[model samples]
Target: MSNNGGNGGGSVLATFEAGTQGWSGTSLAGGPWSTTAWSSQGSRSLQGDITMSAGSQHYLLKSGSTNFTGYTKLRATVKGASWGSYGSGLGVKLFVKHGSSYAWKDSGWVTISAGGLANLTLDLAGVNLADIKEYGIQFIGASNASGTTAVYVDNVVLGN
Candidate 1:
Protein backbone atom coordinates (compact mmCIF):
# COMPACT_ATOMS: atom_id res chain seq x y z
CA MET A 1 0.00 0.00 0.00
CA SER A 2 2.48 2.62 -1.25
CA ASN A 3 2.69 5.10 -4.10
CA ASN A 4 5.75 5.19 -6.36
CA GLY A 5 5.71 8.37 -8.39
CA GLY A 6 7.67 8.47 -11.64
CA ASN A 7 7.35 10.11 -15.06
CA GLY A 8 4.40 12.19 -13.95
CA GLY A 9 3.93 10.00 -10.87
CA GLY A 10 3.31 6.38 -9.77
CA SER A 11 4.42 3.88 -12.37
CA VAL A 12 3.74 0.17 -12.02
CA LEU A 13 6.56 -2.29 -12.62
CA ALA A 14 6.66 -6.02 -11.89
CA THR A 15 3.76 -6.80 -9.58
CA PHE A 16 4.43 -10.55 -9.75
CA GLU A 17 0.63 -10.81 -9.81
CA ALA A 18 0.74 -13.51 -12.48
CA GLY A 19 3.91 -15.32 -11.62
CA THR A 20 7.49 -14.09 -12.12
CA GLN A 21 6.52 -13.53 -15.75
CA GLY A 22 10.01 -12.59 -16.94
CA TRP A 23 12.19 -13.03 -13.87
CA SER A 24 15.06 -15.46 -13.45
CA GLY A 25 17.64 -16.54 -10.87
CA THR A 26 21.31 -17.53 -10.69
CA SER A 27 22.46 -19.11 -7.49
CA LEU A 28 25.63 -20.75 -6.39
CA ALA A 29 24.29 -22.10 -3.10
CA GLY A 30 20.59 -21.37 -2.94
CA GLY A 31 17.22 -21.94 -4.51
CA PRO A 32 15.21 -19.73 -6.89
CA TRP A 33 12.78 -16.87 -6.43
CA SER A 34 9.31 -18.28 -6.53
CA THR A 35 5.86 -16.76 -6.24
CA THR A 36 4.36 -19.11 -3.71
CA ALA A 37 2.69 -16.96 -1.01
CA TRP A 38 0.56 -13.88 -1.15
CA SER A 39 2.36 -11.26 0.90
CA SER A 40 1.42 -7.68 1.66
CA GLN A 41 -1.24 -6.02 -0.46
CA GLY A 42 -2.68 -9.44 -1.07
CA SER A 43 -0.28 -10.40 -3.86
CA ARG A 44 2.24 -13.19 -4.25
CA SER A 45 5.54 -12.47 -2.58
CA LEU A 46 8.82 -13.36 -4.26
CA GLN A 47 10.61 -15.85 -2.04
CA GLY A 48 14.31 -16.73 -2.03
CA ASP A 49 15.85 -19.65 -0.18
CA ILE A 50 19.56 -19.79 0.62
CA THR A 51 21.64 -22.60 2.04
CA MET A 52 25.31 -22.13 2.82
CA SER A 53 27.15 -25.06 4.34
CA ALA A 54 30.44 -23.40 3.47
CA GLY A 55 29.54 -20.03 1.94
CA SER A 56 26.62 -18.20 0.40
CA GLN A 57 26.12 -16.40 -2.89
CA HIS A 58 22.58 -16.49 -4.10
CA TYR A 59 20.67 -14.28 -6.47
CA LEU A 60 17.17 -13.32 -7.53
CA LEU A 61 17.72 -11.50 -10.76
CA LYS A 62 15.38 -9.96 -13.31
CA SER A 63 16.55 -9.46 -16.87
CA GLY A 64 15.24 -9.12 -20.45
CA SER A 65 14.72 -5.35 -20.46
CA THR A 66 12.34 -3.05 -18.52
CA ASN A 67 10.22 0.03 -19.17
CA PHE A 68 11.42 2.12 -16.23
CA THR A 69 11.78 4.99 -18.67
CA GLY A 70 11.04 7.80 -16.23
CA TYR A 71 11.44 6.29 -12.81
CA THR A 72 13.66 7.95 -10.21
CA LYS A 73 13.72 5.34 -7.46
CA LEU A 74 13.11 1.67 -6.68
CA ARG A 75 11.33 0.24 -3.65
CA ALA A 76 10.39 -3.09 -2.12
CA THR A 77 9.09 -4.77 1.02
CA VAL A 78 11.73 -7.17 2.30
CA LYS A 79 11.91 -9.65 5.17
CA GLY A 80 14.37 -12.25 6.39
CA ALA A 81 14.21 -15.48 8.41
CA SER A 82 16.58 -17.78 10.33
CA TRP A 83 18.71 -14.81 11.27
CA GLY A 84 17.92 -14.45 14.96
CA SER A 85 19.12 -17.94 15.70
CA TYR A 86 22.34 -17.35 13.81
CA GLY A 87 23.01 -14.07 15.67
CA SER A 88 23.74 -12.44 12.31
CA GLY A 89 21.38 -10.38 10.27
CA LEU A 90 20.66 -10.82 6.57
CA GLY A 91 21.80 -8.52 3.82
CA VAL A 92 19.98 -8.19 0.55
CA LYS A 93 22.06 -6.70 -2.23
CA LEU A 94 20.43 -4.54 -4.84
CA PHE A 95 21.71 -4.43 -8.42
CA VAL A 96 20.54 -1.89 -10.97
CA LYS A 97 21.61 -2.77 -14.45
CA HIS A 98 22.31 -0.12 -17.03
CA GLY A 99 20.91 -1.23 -20.34
CA SER A 100 22.93 -1.97 -23.49
CA SER A 101 26.18 -1.14 -21.68
CA TYR A 102 25.57 -4.09 -19.31
CA ALA A 103 27.17 -2.27 -16.40
CA TRP A 104 25.52 -2.27 -12.99
CA LYS A 105 24.87 0.23 -10.20
CA ASP A 106 25.10 -1.62 -6.95
CA SER A 107 23.80 -0.62 -3.53
CA GLY A 108 25.34 -1.51 -0.21
CA TRP A 109 23.72 -4.25 1.83
CA VAL A 110 20.21 -3.73 3.21
CA THR A 111 20.04 -5.37 6.59
CA ILE A 112 16.83 -7.14 7.57
CA SER A 113 15.86 -8.70 10.86
CA ALA A 114 14.84 -12.28 11.45
CA GLY A 115 11.23 -12.65 10.40
CA GLY A 116 10.77 -8.91 10.36
CA LEU A 117 9.61 -6.71 7.50
CA ALA A 118 11.38 -3.61 6.28
CA ASN A 119 10.93 -1.09 3.50
CA LEU A 120 13.86 -0.43 1.20
CA THR A 121 14.57 2.35 -1.25
CA LEU A 122 17.36 2.65 -3.79
CA ASP A 123 17.79 5.99 -5.46
CA LEU A 124 18.11 5.76 -9.23
CA ALA A 125 19.81 9.09 -9.58
CA GLY A 126 21.79 9.33 -12.84
CA VAL A 127 20.57 5.90 -13.87
CA ASN A 128 19.23 5.41 -17.38
CA LEU A 129 15.70 4.27 -16.85
CA ALA A 130 14.67 3.48 -20.40
CA ASP A 131 17.90 1.58 -20.92
CA ILE A 132 17.77 -0.62 -17.82
CA LYS A 133 18.42 -4.23 -18.79
CA GLU A 134 18.23 -6.03 -15.46
CA TYR A 135 17.62 -5.83 -11.71
CA GLY A 136 18.88 -8.19 -9.03
CA ILE A 137 18.92 -9.11 -5.34
CA GLN A 138 21.88 -10.95 -3.91
CA PHE A 139 21.90 -12.93 -0.66
CA ILE A 140 25.38 -13.15 0.77
CA GLY A 141 27.10 -14.31 3.93
CA ALA A 142 30.48 -14.26 5.56
CA SER A 143 32.96 -16.95 4.63
CA ASN A 144 32.47 -20.60 5.57
CA ALA A 145 29.19 -20.43 7.39
CA SER A 146 26.69 -23.23 7.89
CA GLY A 147 23.02 -22.34 7.66
CA THR A 148 19.88 -22.06 5.58
CA THR A 149 18.16 -18.69 5.30
CA ALA A 150 15.46 -16.97 3.33
CA VAL A 151 14.10 -13.58 2.30
CA TYR A 152 10.57 -12.68 1.33
CA VAL A 153 9.64 -9.73 -0.87
CA ASP A 154 6.48 -8.13 -2.15
CA ASN A 155 5.42 -5.02 -4.08
CA VAL A 156 8.57 -4.21 -5.98
CA VAL A 157 7.92 -0.80 -7.51
CA LEU A 158 9.97 1.65 -9.55
CA GLY A 159 9.25 5.26 -8.76
CA ASN A 160 10.07 8.91 -9.00
Candidate 2:
Protein backbone atom coordinates (compact mmCIF):
# COMPACT_ATOMS: atom_id res chain seq x y z
CA MET A 1 0.00 0.00 0.00
CA SER A 2 0.88 3.74 -0.37
CA ASN A 3 2.96 3.03 -3.47
CA ASN A 4 5.50 1.55 -1.12
CA GLY A 5 5.81 4.84 0.77
CA GLY A 6 5.26 7.14 -2.20
CA ASN A 7 3.12 10.23 -1.58
CA GLY A 8 1.71 10.56 -5.12
CA GLY A 9 1.94 14.37 -5.59
CA GLY A 10 4.38 15.40 -2.85
CA SER A 11 7.70 14.60 -1.31
CA VAL A 12 7.92 12.22 1.61
CA LEU A 13 7.85 13.97 4.96
CA ALA A 14 9.06 11.18 7.21
CA THR A 15 9.47 7.40 7.09
CA PHE A 16 10.65 6.82 10.68
CA GLU A 17 13.18 4.27 9.37
CA ALA A 18 15.92 6.08 11.22
CA GLY A 19 14.81 5.11 14.68
CA THR A 20 11.67 7.09 15.53
CA GLN A 21 13.02 10.22 13.75
CA GLY A 22 12.49 12.59 16.66
CA TRP A 23 9.05 11.18 17.49
CA SER A 24 8.43 9.80 20.92
CA GLY A 25 5.76 7.60 22.45
CA THR A 26 3.43 9.11 25.03
CA SER A 27 1.13 7.22 27.34
CA LEU A 28 -1.77 9.58 27.41
CA ALA A 29 -4.40 9.35 30.15
CA GLY A 30 -1.79 7.41 32.10
CA GLY A 31 -2.56 4.30 30.07
CA PRO A 32 -0.25 1.37 30.39
CA TRP A 33 1.07 1.79 26.90
CA SER A 34 4.56 0.95 25.73
CA THR A 35 6.32 1.07 22.40
CA THR A 36 8.48 -1.40 20.56
CA ALA A 37 9.87 -2.08 17.10
CA TRP A 38 8.89 -4.76 14.66
CA SER A 39 8.89 -5.44 10.93
CA SER A 40 6.50 -3.76 8.57
CA GLN A 41 6.77 -3.58 4.79
CA GLY A 42 10.24 -5.05 5.11
CA SER A 43 11.39 -2.22 7.39
CA ARG A 44 11.11 -1.55 11.08
CA SER A 45 7.75 -0.53 12.47
CA LEU A 46 6.84 1.22 15.70
CA GLN A 47 4.36 -0.78 17.70
CA GLY A 48 2.23 0.74 20.43
CA ASP A 49 0.90 -1.79 22.90
CA ILE A 50 -1.43 -1.29 25.78
CA THR A 51 0.50 -3.52 28.10
CA MET A 52 -1.76 -2.58 30.97
CA SER A 53 -5.09 -0.86 31.11
CA ALA A 54 -6.90 1.81 32.98
CA GLY A 55 -10.41 2.97 32.33
CA SER A 56 -10.43 5.10 29.19
CA GLN A 57 -6.76 4.64 28.44
CA HIS A 58 -5.19 6.87 25.80
CA TYR A 59 -1.82 7.09 24.10
CA LEU A 60 -0.05 9.03 21.35
CA LEU A 61 3.05 9.18 19.23
CA LYS A 62 4.23 12.77 19.02
CA SER A 63 7.11 15.01 17.98
CA GLY A 64 7.48 18.52 16.58
CA SER A 65 8.59 21.38 14.31
CA THR A 66 8.31 19.88 10.82
CA ASN A 67 7.19 23.01 8.95
CA PHE A 68 4.64 21.11 6.89
CA THR A 69 3.53 24.12 4.88
CA GLY A 70 1.78 23.37 1.58
CA TYR A 71 1.25 19.76 2.40
CA THR A 72 -2.43 18.91 2.20
CA LYS A 73 -2.45 15.37 3.46
CA LEU A 74 -0.84 12.84 5.76
CA ARG A 75 -0.68 9.13 5.03
CA ALA A 76 0.12 6.41 7.47
CA THR A 77 0.26 2.60 7.11
CA VAL A 78 -0.96 0.86 10.19
CA LYS A 79 -2.33 -2.34 11.66
CA GLY A 80 -4.38 -2.94 14.76
CA ALA A 81 -5.17 -5.85 17.04
CA SER A 82 -7.64 -6.05 19.90
CA TRP A 83 -8.38 -2.33 20.46
CA GLY A 84 -11.71 -3.28 21.95
CA SER A 85 -14.82 -2.19 20.07
CA TYR A 86 -14.85 0.40 17.34
CA GLY A 87 -16.93 2.87 19.32
CA SER A 88 -16.31 2.12 22.95
CA GLY A 89 -12.95 0.39 23.01
CA LEU A 90 -10.18 1.33 20.63
CA GLY A 91 -10.16 4.32 18.25
CA VAL A 92 -7.49 6.41 16.54
CA LYS A 93 -7.14 10.05 15.57
CA LEU A 94 -4.80 12.33 13.72
CA PHE A 95 -3.88 15.76 15.06
CA VAL A 96 -1.82 18.68 13.82
CA LYS A 97 -0.26 21.56 15.68
CA HIS A 98 -2.08 24.84 15.30
CA GLY A 99 -1.29 28.50 15.73
CA SER A 100 1.80 30.01 17.40
CA SER A 101 1.29 28.70 20.91
CA TYR A 102 1.10 24.97 20.06
CA ALA A 103 -2.59 24.20 19.94
CA TRP A 104 -3.90 21.07 18.21
CA LYS A 105 -6.32 20.59 15.39
CA ASP A 106 -8.18 17.30 15.46
CA SER A 107 -7.79 16.46 11.82
CA GLY A 108 -9.78 13.24 11.68
CA TRP A 109 -10.58 9.92 13.27
CA VAL A 110 -9.27 6.58 11.99
CA THR A 111 -11.21 3.37 12.24
CA ILE A 112 -9.17 0.43 13.47
CA SER A 113 -10.63 -2.99 12.81
CA ALA A 114 -9.34 -5.65 15.08
CA GLY A 115 -6.22 -7.36 13.65
CA GLY A 116 -6.33 -5.54 10.38
CA LEU A 117 -3.76 -3.69 8.30
CA ALA A 118 -4.90 -0.40 6.87
CA ASN A 119 -3.48 2.39 4.80
CA LEU A 120 -5.18 5.55 5.93
CA THR A 121 -4.91 9.21 4.94
CA LEU A 122 -5.99 12.44 6.62
CA ASP A 123 -6.81 15.77 5.04
CA LEU A 124 -4.82 18.81 6.10
CA ALA A 125 -6.64 21.22 3.82
CA GLY A 126 -8.08 23.71 6.32
CA VAL A 127 -5.31 24.09 8.87
CA ASN A 128 -2.65 26.78 8.98
CA LEU A 129 0.03 24.63 7.47
CA ALA A 130 2.53 27.46 7.54
CA ASP A 131 2.62 27.37 11.31
CA ILE A 132 2.47 23.60 11.64
CA LYS A 133 4.70 22.29 14.34
CA GLU A 134 4.03 18.55 14.27
CA TYR A 135 1.56 15.71 13.64
CA GLY A 136 0.90 12.39 15.35
CA ILE A 137 -1.56 9.60 16.17
CA GLN A 138 -3.81 9.47 19.21
CA PHE A 139 -5.76 6.53 20.60
CA ILE A 140 -9.21 7.28 21.96
CA GLY A 141 -12.07 5.32 23.52
CA ALA A 142 -9.72 2.72 24.90
CA SER A 143 -11.63 2.15 28.09
CA ASN A 144 -13.51 -1.07 27.43
CA ALA A 145 -10.50 -2.92 26.11
CA SER A 146 -7.88 -4.67 28.13
CA GLY A 147 -4.12 -4.58 27.67
CA THR A 148 -4.45 -6.62 24.49
CA THR A 149 -4.96 -3.60 22.27
CA ALA A 150 -2.06 -2.75 20.00
CA VAL A 151 -1.31 -0.63 16.93
CA TYR A 152 1.63 -0.86 14.58
CA VAL A 153 2.73 2.23 12.70
CA ASP A 154 4.90 2.53 9.64
CA ASN A 155 5.51 4.67 6.55
CA VAL A 156 3.91 7.83 7.93
CA VAL A 157 4.41 10.21 5.02
CA LEU A 158 3.10 13.72 4.47
CA GLY A 159 2.22 14.99 1.05
CA ASN A 160 0.66 17.77 -0.98
Candidate 3:
Protein backbone atom coordinates (compact mmCIF):
# COMPACT_ATOMS: atom_id res chain seq x y z
CA MET A 1 0.00 0.00 0.00
CA SER A 2 1.09 3.50 -0.69
CA ASN A 3 1.81 5.63 2.31
CA ASN A 4 0.23 9.04 1.88
CA GLY A 5 0.53 11.11 4.99
CA GLY A 6 -0.06 14.75 5.60
CA ASN A 7 -0.71 17.44 8.23
CA GLY A 8 -4.42 16.56 8.31
CA GLY A 9 -3.69 13.52 10.48
CA GLY A 10 -2.50 11.45 7.55
CA SER A 11 -6.05 10.41 6.75
CA VAL A 12 -7.99 10.41 3.55
CA LEU A 13 -10.45 13.27 3.58
CA ALA A 14 -12.94 11.92 1.06
CA THR A 15 -13.10 9.60 -1.91
CA PHE A 16 -15.93 9.19 -4.45
CA GLU A 17 -15.91 6.14 -6.68
CA ALA A 18 -18.12 5.99 -9.77
CA GLY A 19 -21.43 4.10 -9.39
CA THR A 20 -20.92 4.48 -5.67
CA GLN A 21 -21.27 7.16 -3.01
CA GLY A 22 -22.53 10.41 -4.55
CA TRP A 23 -25.65 12.56 -4.33
CA SER A 24 -28.41 13.30 -6.84
CA GLY A 25 -31.55 15.38 -6.88
CA THR A 26 -35.16 14.63 -7.80
CA SER A 27 -35.53 12.59 -10.93
CA LEU A 28 -36.08 15.13 -13.61
CA ALA A 29 -37.21 14.27 -17.10
CA GLY A 30 -34.13 12.61 -18.57
CA GLY A 31 -31.94 14.12 -15.91
CA PRO A 32 -28.42 12.75 -15.95
CA TRP A 33 -27.89 12.93 -12.21
CA SER A 34 -31.21 11.22 -11.72
CA THR A 35 -30.61 8.28 -14.04
CA THR A 36 -26.99 7.65 -13.08
CA ALA A 37 -25.96 5.59 -10.06
CA TRP A 38 -25.06 8.57 -7.93
CA SER A 39 -26.63 9.27 -4.55
CA SER A 40 -30.03 10.95 -4.76
CA GLN A 41 -31.32 14.17 -3.29
CA GLY A 42 -34.82 15.63 -3.38
CA SER A 43 -33.97 19.09 -4.59
CA ARG A 44 -34.63 19.73 -8.28
CA SER A 45 -34.85 22.92 -10.23
CA LEU A 46 -35.61 24.36 -13.64
CA GLN A 47 -31.98 25.33 -13.91
CA GLY A 48 -30.33 22.08 -12.92
CA ASP A 49 -29.55 20.81 -9.44
CA ILE A 50 -26.56 20.78 -7.14
CA THR A 51 -26.38 17.30 -5.68
CA MET A 52 -23.57 15.70 -3.74
CA SER A 53 -22.59 12.44 -5.36
CA ALA A 54 -20.76 11.14 -2.30
CA GLY A 55 -20.44 13.26 0.81
CA SER A 56 -22.74 15.80 2.44
CA GLN A 57 -24.17 18.52 0.29
CA HIS A 58 -23.93 21.29 2.86
CA TYR A 59 -20.61 20.15 4.25
CA LEU A 60 -17.67 18.80 2.31
CA LEU A 61 -15.32 16.11 3.64
CA LYS A 62 -12.94 18.53 5.28
CA SER A 63 -15.73 20.66 6.69
CA GLY A 64 -15.44 21.30 10.41
CA SER A 65 -12.06 19.56 10.36
CA THR A 66 -8.82 21.24 11.14
CA ASN A 67 -7.83 23.79 8.55
CA PHE A 68 -5.47 22.22 6.07
CA THR A 69 -2.45 24.49 6.18
CA GLY A 70 -0.20 22.48 3.90
CA TYR A 71 -0.18 21.52 0.28
CA THR A 72 -3.70 20.49 -0.73
CA LYS A 73 -5.60 19.75 -3.88
CA LEU A 74 -9.18 19.24 -5.06
CA ARG A 75 -9.89 16.98 -7.99
CA ALA A 76 -12.95 15.57 -9.72
CA THR A 77 -14.28 14.03 -12.93
CA VAL A 78 -17.43 15.45 -14.50
CA LYS A 79 -19.76 15.00 -17.47
CA GLY A 80 -22.99 16.53 -18.72
CA ALA A 81 -26.20 15.16 -20.14
CA SER A 82 -28.33 15.88 -23.18
CA TRP A 83 -30.56 18.88 -22.65
CA GLY A 84 -29.34 20.43 -25.75
CA SER A 85 -26.64 22.96 -24.97
CA TYR A 86 -28.85 24.31 -22.21
CA GLY A 87 -27.58 22.03 -19.50
CA SER A 88 -24.20 21.05 -20.86
CA GLY A 89 -22.22 23.47 -18.74
CA LEU A 90 -21.42 22.66 -15.11
CA GLY A 91 -19.33 24.37 -12.49
CA VAL A 92 -17.52 23.53 -9.25
CA LYS A 93 -17.22 26.02 -6.45
CA LEU A 94 -14.78 25.99 -3.54
CA PHE A 95 -15.77 27.72 -0.36
CA VAL A 96 -13.99 28.71 2.80
CA LYS A 97 -15.76 29.50 6.05
CA HIS A 98 -15.67 33.00 7.34
CA GLY A 99 -17.13 33.64 10.79
CA SER A 100 -20.34 31.59 10.61
CA SER A 101 -20.83 31.59 6.88
CA TYR A 102 -19.16 29.99 3.89
CA ALA A 103 -17.99 32.13 1.01
CA TRP A 104 -17.26 31.34 -2.58
CA LYS A 105 -13.50 31.46 -3.08
CA ASP A 106 -12.92 29.67 -6.36
CA SER A 107 -14.95 28.25 -9.22
CA GLY A 108 -14.33 26.28 -12.44
CA TRP A 109 -16.74 25.62 -15.29
CA VAL A 110 -16.76 22.70 -17.72
CA THR A 111 -18.84 21.77 -20.74
CA ILE A 112 -19.67 18.21 -21.74
CA SER A 113 -20.66 17.88 -25.32
CA ALA A 114 -20.63 14.49 -27.10
CA GLY A 115 -20.45 12.90 -23.65
CA GLY A 116 -16.80 12.86 -22.58
CA LEU A 117 -14.89 13.08 -19.35
CA ALA A 118 -13.20 16.19 -18.02
CA ASN A 119 -10.75 16.23 -15.15
CA LEU A 120 -10.49 19.27 -12.89
CA THR A 121 -7.89 20.17 -10.28
CA LEU A 122 -7.74 23.15 -7.94
CA ASP A 123 -4.65 24.04 -5.98
CA LEU A 124 -5.31 25.19 -2.41
CA ALA A 125 -1.95 26.69 -1.60
CA GLY A 126 -2.91 30.22 -0.56
CA VAL A 127 -6.50 29.61 0.46
CA ASN A 128 -7.35 28.78 4.03
CA LEU A 129 -8.22 25.16 3.68
CA ALA A 130 -8.69 24.86 7.42
CA ASP A 131 -11.63 27.24 7.45
CA ILE A 132 -13.39 25.47 4.63
CA LYS A 133 -16.32 23.52 5.99
CA GLU A 134 -18.48 23.34 2.91
CA TYR A 135 -18.01 23.26 -0.85
CA GLY A 136 -20.43 22.91 -3.74
CA ILE A 137 -20.81 21.56 -7.29
CA GLN A 138 -23.40 23.18 -9.50
CA PHE A 139 -24.81 22.55 -12.96
CA ILE A 140 -25.26 25.71 -14.98
CA GLY A 141 -27.87 26.01 -17.66
CA ALA A 142 -27.38 27.68 -21.02
CA SER A 143 -27.04 31.39 -20.66
CA ASN A 144 -30.37 33.25 -20.83
CA ALA A 145 -32.39 30.07 -20.50
CA SER A 146 -34.23 28.37 -17.63
CA GLY A 147 -34.76 24.61 -17.62
CA THR A 148 -33.63 21.39 -16.04
CA THR A 149 -30.46 19.63 -17.14
CA ALA A 150 -28.51 16.58 -16.03
CA VAL A 151 -24.89 16.08 -15.13
CA TYR A 152 -22.59 13.34 -13.82
CA VAL A 153 -19.90 13.84 -11.24
CA ASP A 154 -17.49 11.30 -9.89
CA ASN A 155 -14.02 10.51 -8.59
CA VAL A 156 -13.94 13.41 -6.17
CA VAL A 157 -10.74 13.03 -4.20
CA LEU A 158 -9.01 15.47 -1.90
CA GLY A 159 -5.41 15.05 -0.88
CA ASN A 160 -2.22 16.76 0.16
Candidate 3 error regions (>4 Å): 1-69, 83-101, 144-147
Q: Please give the TM-score that candidate 2 achieves against the real structure.
A: 0.73
Number of colliding residue pairs in each model: 3, 1, 11
Model 2 residue runs over 4 Å out of place are 1-4, 28-40, 51-57, 82-89
What is the C-alpha lDDT profile of model 2 across 98-151, one tens digit per residue? 668777776466556567666767788777776777676766544444545566
Candidate lDDT values, in order: 0.64, 0.60, 0.41
Q: Candidate 3, residue 29: CA error in Å? A: 8.4
Point out the worst 10-residue segment of candidate 2 by lDDT.
28-37
lDDT digits (tens) for residues 1-160 of candidate 3? 1223232333333333222233333323432222333321222211223332222122222235345555477655455445443333333343334234564554455544524446666666666666765543544334433444345554444656
- Comparing 1 with 3 on lDDT, the higher-scoring candidate is 1
Q: Tell me, by TM-score, which candidate is best.
A: 1
Let me know the TM-score candidate 1 reaches against the reference structure: 0.78
**TM-scores of all models?**
0.78, 0.73, 0.52
